[model samples]
Target: MASMPGPTDAFARPLTDLRVSVTDRCNFRCRYCMPREIFGPDHAFLERDELLSFEEITRLVGLFTTLGVHKVRLTGGEPLLRSDLPTLIAGIAGLDRITDLALTTNGTLLPRHAADLAAAGLDRVTVSLDALDDEIHRAISDTRVPVTAVLAGIEAARAAGLPVKVNTVVKRGVNDDEITAMAAWGRREGITVRFIEYMDVGATNGWRLDDVVPAAEVVERLSTLGPLEPIGDGTPGGDVGDVQTGPGQVAERLRWSDGAGEVGVIASVTRPFCRTCSRARLSSVGELFTCLFATSGTDLRGPLRDGATDDEVVTIARDTWTHRTDRYSEERTAETARDDRVEMSYIGG
Candidate 1:
């Protein structure tokens, strides 16, 4: 098969990864992404009719694959909450062009669905596990669920033969004390725990520079636990000691020099990788957002529902990407920070 034309943006970045949000509801109200104070019981989530159907999502995935999107991750406020997720997973996995199929979840529900998710062609899973300390975990996630539940989910995912990666959002005073604990746990379990710098993704969460824990600080803290080395550093034809594990890879992966284990860090705020970001996000309602901090998205749902053909939808998406010039994180400022960016809950982080 000849190569399909890539949707190269204004900065010459091709769309290689797509994060599709299947639903805008979650079980846990993580303070960083979604806070209970705001997303309370009365909060209005997208109605079932407003969300894209599984078939519509599958069609969009097919279109994305043709635009050089080889990696597709199913995300959500909590993807498992979307009913019959395996069916959607099977549809995307069947698209031969989608070489990588993954999902990001809070992990509380993985124990029941991991096997089913894996059976339906999921290649791997990323679980948002902020801390192993039960109290700290509850504090960050703002949920009554115990930490052991998430651990069980991780075990279930591994039992299902799916590679698991844990994501920890490091905020200075919130979970910073547990950095070493989390790293040690990851080393002990042979799971790659990625520490993400506290980012100002949405309008809420009381984001502040003081709360932000720089990636360099995280590396320093982990170094106290063990001698860490970049995954490919000091080796021939290997990536140097940087957050970049590979081309367009966001995390800078490193390993324990003593042969214990490995971890990664995403320094979006301090060490921005906007220049090489190849991700395009689709909201539950079919809006395409070029940047995670985007205030608005091109409404593909309206166009598609209004009787637009597949060719027309493709043209619209391609045109949006080709004309994209967003680099929000790299240019983040107090003024821009208050730009009413879309909430991370609405669009999967």
Candidate 2:
């Protein structure tokens, strides 16, 4: 098949990844992404009628593929909360031009659905697990769910033939002590573990600059466990498949000197990669956000539900992306970071 025409934004960044939020409800209220005080019992979530149907999501995925999105990741407040999610996964996997299809989850429910999801054509799974200690894990997730259950979920994903990458968000006073433990565990388990700097992504996370444990510090801390070598230095003239530590990638790849394992650090707060960011996010309600820190999104739900044609939806998406010049992370400041941004739960982290 002929390749789809590539669309570039004002900064000339091509769109290649799309994160689709299937739902806006989660079982756990992580302190970073979703705090309990704000998202309390009375907090209202999107009704079923407000969400984009599986068919609608599939249509948008197809449209996005036509504009150079070969990778699609299913995300949510917790995607497992969505009913019959495997059906949506199958629908998206059936589409042409999607080279990669993955999902990001908290892993509370992966044990029950891992095999089904793999059968439905999921390529890989990125599980969010912060601490291995039960007490710390419970505190970070703000739930009674045990750490053992999440580990079981990871094992289940592996058993189902799905490659797994574990994501741990490191906050200074919160879970920074677990850096070596998490890295050691990843090395032993043979799963690539990534440490993400605590970011001021949404308006309600009560973000503070002091809370962020810089990626450099994390790598330095890991070196105490074993010698670490940086992978993918952003140098010119390397193999095409070689991971380049440059713009667009959220993570800086690294490996153990002993060759036991590899790790990644996502320093979006400190080492911003806005120049080559190729991701566009779609909310469960069908709003298209050009940037993670965007205050507003183009409401595709209105146009689609109002009987707009496929070509019309494609034009809206293409035009919105074509005119994109978002570099919020690169320009983030103490004052600017406090600006009202969409809640990460509404979209996806």
Candidate 3:
């Protein structure tokens, strides 16, 4: 038996979570994410061979596991759009070191893949659903994708025994009106609805400081339906803040000082939590991103393809994480207001 390697951060900002983008392709043309105009029919995505193979990804995951990554999330432009993604899920699940394994998807393809993903050892799922109405959803996403597809997908995930979480990005003058309705939908479906403040992760979204519907407004709107009690704060892994919503008012995962179903806000725009951001993202092309708003990443593809040793990769990974001082959202209104940032599609959300 071999002993595990010691950690690098003394559990300070430890590498506990890894988000791997399986593909840079998606089905919808979300205006904020991957607008069709920028990623039109002529867009050149990475070829199948250019992507990190499941075998290669698993090797890296094994290394990440040894370096203290206990949770893994599969993300992408849309993860299910990738071929045989459940196979990749199973491969990661086989690694016993991972305590929590999850996937984030657009939910357009989830109805077809939920059970298979759960069977592949996926522990949970987070679905990106901006609206409940078909027309509004299509308009917001800049695609004709029906909201019923997402609803059906959520149902399928529930039936598959996967704990479902719904993420709604609240963009002012867009889908912000749906906050209450979205929270209602989540409560009815037994899903945790997390409202995320509109962020300027990339330069393509036409992000303006005024376009951001603050997290406080999200709570206020949802409070219209029912009284929202402040559930105590959760861990720093996701920067989730407390708010509970329900009819009977019974909260589950969130330890509510007053009982109700849990609701949270990812205050990326107003209350940036970059200091506690412990997650790292790996692009489908094998680039490693230290922060979500990063303009560029260290190209691990070259080194990995060239047969870099695990020790070398891990050292690079640690150095990158330790040296990271990104606070993009916090500085956006000031320093980055005039700067151009990378598109979210290239890095996955």
Candidate 4:
């Protein structure tokens, strides 16, 4: 028999995806996330002892699978910054219940760790690169790391036989002009690209409603290549990363009508996906967050480290998830956007 839904929140949304933040330390202080003004030189990051050990993480992941999570993605302020990260990848890959395992990174480190990461059982990677132009890339990431570095990382991942996708956050008057350019690059490179609407993830990004380039317009601009078609069930070429569709899916995958290539868009701003949202974020220090815009999180680390039994810990997660009433995106307003929510860097994007 096929497996039934695991655990459902207040709205009956099943928990299927777990984004695990391996660490909170990042190399690049992207303006949208860990901006230099805030995460400047004087800022302090998590200590090694404070973060969940690989054993603790793997154990928690195992319990998550029992609660209906089959997809796991390793994330970070920059996951590659974590030392001996392949060890953690290897551990998560060993979990029998995990159907898919992926990671999101800045991609600068992939050139050095791609082969090792793939060899350790990483399934795929999604690199965060905003623009092809050096100036725009520099402005967005607030770093001198050239676009060439990210491109090199993509090549390295490909050579290691790991599927690669590029994620671009489109902020109006920012990188919005690069939508078609990005699609063209992906087509030329035979890679899948996903465009994300600039979201009010954290309070400090200075989010404005007008700054959001709607996903429809992004898709419209890309349609210039050729009319795009939604890549849904039974759609050919939809097998890219085996990306799913329907309820609880974030990215809406689409392919060129002429079949030249494929692309996707995440319209969280103009279109709220809260009704079927199924992702649970485990913070770098072990807080279990039920929503991306959550103001507070349930501290699983405290109880786990306090010697709670596996059953007890599992109960904590289940109860917290079951009682969750998060719909921040659906109810986003000028007011809600100002809520002091958790930073994307702390929980990974």
Candidate 5:
């Protein structure tokens, strides 16, 4: 396949990363994402037929690669919930243009599939674990599954030779108290722990400004555990000393001064990095979303199902990216923050 030059958005941000949601089904209903009240048993998820097949996903990825997407991250309500996911991983890995093939999951199912995923050419995995306390974790996840189960999964991923990163969404009055403990645990395990501010991704999480524990506050609290050296300028578009900063990395990297370990804080709320954002998300059903807070998406599945050629898909992708002007985080006011946006579970975080 001949490579086409990738397109840059209106802000001159090149499209380099693609997040594909494999499924919309998840077992745990986290309040910030799939709140139990909204995603209840009665809630209707996409039918199996509605999801993009492995072949279709691979085909789109091939087109995306031509448009300058070098990294592909598989996500979902729970990507592991999708059946035979390793096969999909292997298919995407076979692509020469895809330099990085990763997945983000809740970590409960990693114990069962981590080895298989690694063998199938998965480069890395990011596990979402909000709290270390069993009760806090249960309250956050709204599932009976305990913290030990998730920890075991993390170990399983490491044992399978897959580098792991733990993501924690710190919300005030929810699990903010566990920030230090979570960071210490990740340090002990020699894994990078990233703290994310509670964001208003969807309308159902009861998102309130007061609920957010700013990244600065998180850093302050983590510093109490040990001296934390700013790993970078801690500003948008700043250089990362020796570490290579990716195209759309929102996390401000930091390291413990004593060399225990490194941690990251994604202050999307307090310090938005929208200017350097270069990611495009595709839902399980193939809707292309340029922004996480977008209310609508371009229906790529329709074109794919209609037997549109690769050139046609590429045109749509390039045009959509070229016109992209989304910067929700930077412009998030109280009024605009409550706009009806796509669910984080449906499009991946």
Candidate 6:
């Protein structure tokens, strides 16, 4: 048998997490990620051969584990939409070096698949839930998809014994009004809810700086409903911070937790955590993205399909990661001007 690979020759940034997009297809068309009208019938998605198969994904993941990545999150435009996803999950979970294996989905298909997914050894699940009210949810998602389905999906995942995190992208004048309601639902369900800033991820979203509902404002809005005392960060591996920067930032940190389940804000836009950003995204088509806002990615698929050894793939992945210096959020002004960035649906959130 081949000896295990050594420390990555060029890996840097203290990398520890990898997000793999299993498919580029989504059932819902969230305005920010993929507006429905634009993504209608004519838009071309990846063909069957373009996507990395389960075996190919496992090989890439094995190399990532060798390069000091310990956690992996399966994502997609909507991961659950992919058929037999649990089989893929089981394969990745079998990798002993991968301590954490989670998935992010739109929750439209989770109710039917949650149990199987948990049984397949997925460690955790996060579902995107934009609103509690069906009308508002339909508006936010830009589809007739009901909010009830997503809520039921969350309940199913919880019943399946999988820890669930509800993710909401709060856009000012849009879903921001639903923050408190969503938090109340989470508290009742005993699920951790994370509010994400409306990010300028892809050019298709028509991201406007005015649309961003700052993390500070989200906590304040929730605090008005009840006294939410700060608790420890729900997951240590979570990108959100547990520490307060100063008195000014303290309110933003503690105001939304009632000591039951915590509220997290991924301040990717307002508070850039680029220096500690240790994420690498593997697109469904086998390109590796160093940054979520990146316009281009190195094609690992070509090399892998060409019979490149694990060492060669590892070297390619390592070189791409080490020379990494992407802080799009910090340099938001400059990044906003670039036109060819990959859409969030293609890269997974």
Q: Distance from true position, residue 124, model 2, in Å?
A: 0.3
* TM-score versus the correct structure, for each prediction: 0.95, 0.96, 0.90, 0.95, 0.97, 0.90
What TM-score quantifies how close candidate 4 is to the native fold?
0.95
Model 1 residue 125 CA deviation in Å: 0.4
lDDT, candidate 1, 1-349, per-residue tens: 2346988999999998899999999999999898999999999889999999999999999988888888899999999999999999999999979878989999999999999999999999999999999999999999999999999999999999999999999998888999999999999999999999999998987787788899999999999997988766422113733222345668887889999878888888888888988899999999999999999999999988898888788889999999999898899876766668899988899
Error of 1 at 92 (Å): 0.3
Query: By TM-score, is 2 or 5 better?
Result: 5
Error of 6 at 307 (Å): 0.5
Q: Which stretches of candidate 1 lie over 4 Å from their true place?
A: 1-3, 233-245
Candidate number of the best lDDT: 5
- Model 2 residue 1 distance off true place after TM-score fit, in angstroms: 13
lDDT of 4 by residue, 1-349 (tens): 2333577999998998899998998989887888888888888989999999998999899888888988899999999999999999999999988878899999999999999999999999999989998899999999989999999999999999999989999999989888889899999899989999999997788888899999989988998888887876523223445544445777888888777778998888887878878899999889999998888898889998999988888889989999999998888997778879999999989
lDDT of each: 0.89, 0.89, 0.76, 0.88, 0.90, 0.79
User: What tens digits encode model 2's per-residue C-alpha lDDT throughout 88-171?
Assistant: 999999998887899999998999999999999999999999999899999999999999999999999999999999999999
How many pairs of residues collide in model 2?
0
- Could you list the CA RMSD of all candidates, in the order they appear? 2.7, 2.2, 4.5, 2.7, 1.5, 4.1
Score residue 117 of candidate 4 by CA lDDT.
92
Tell me the deviation in Å of residue 286 in model 2.
0.2
The better candidate by lDDT, 2 or 4, is 2
List, residue by residue over 1-349, the lDDT tens digit for candidate 6: 2434433223235566789999999888889888977788898988988999999999899888887777799998888877899899999999868878999988878789989999999988888888898888999888887888888888888899988888889998887889989888877777778888888888888787788899878877877767776443422233234222221121123434346666777787787766556778999989999888899999999999999999899889877877787877777874464566889999988
Which pairs in model 5 have colliding backbones? Answer: none
* Alpha carbon deviation, residue 194, candidate 5 (Å): 0.5
Query: Which ten contiguous residues of candidate 5 have the minimum total lDDT?
Result: 235-244
Query: What ordering of candidates by lDDT runs from best to worst?
Result: 5, 2, 1, 4, 6, 3
